[model samples]
Target: MAPLSWYIALSASLFVIGLYGVLSRRNVLIVLMCLELMLSAVNINLVAFSFFLSHLGGQIFAIFVITVTAAEVAVALAIVIAYVRHKGSLKIDEISIMNG
Candidate 1:
């Protein structure tokens, strides 16, 4: 069995990579994908801790996180589609809808 520390390290690495992607990328789709990667890292940590502690709470909470992530992705994609239809581009830096 892999050590808990290894799992934590892996999760942390994934999260950092995702954070960098989200921060540095200009494409909205890429940002959304990076957000998913970050959420996946959280899932990995949850599962790892659940296993290490022999408790189901962490696993259950992870399931809720997955559920929320799915809903978030669905809504975000819908928004993305609308944005593309209106603006014809996916660049996050080009968005000015909130400017008033």
Candidate 2:
């Protein structure tokens, strides 16, 4: 069995990469994907700790997180598609409702 620290390290790395992508990327689609990656990293940590603790709460929470993330992605993508159609640009810097 692998140690819990290894799992934690992996999760942290994923989270950091996702955060960097979100902060540095200009494309809205890529930013959404990075946000999903961050959510996945959280789920991994939840499952790993749940397994280590011999408890089901973390696993349950992870499932809930997955469900919510799915809904968020669906809604966000719909909005992104609409925005792309209406604005004609996917760049984050180009998107703003307050300017209109």
**Model 1 spans > 4 angstroms off:** none
lDDT of candidate 1 over 1-100, digit per residue (tens)? 8999999999999999999999999999999999999999999999999999999999999999999999999999999999999989999999889896
TM-score of each: 0.97, 0.96
After TM-score superposition, the amount by which residue 53's alpha carbon in candidate 2 deviates from its true location, in angstroms, is 0.4
Which candidate has the top score in lDDT?
A: 1
All-Cα superposition RMSD per candidate: 0.7, 1.0
**lDDT (C-alpha, whole model) for all candidates:** 0.97, 0.96
Put down candidate 2 lDDT per residue, 1-74, tens digits, no spaces. 99999999999999999999999999999999999999999999999999999999999999999999999999
Q: Candidate 2: what lDDT?
A: 0.96
Model 2 regions lying over 4 Å from their true place? none
Q: What is the lDDT of residue 2 in candidate 2?
A: 99
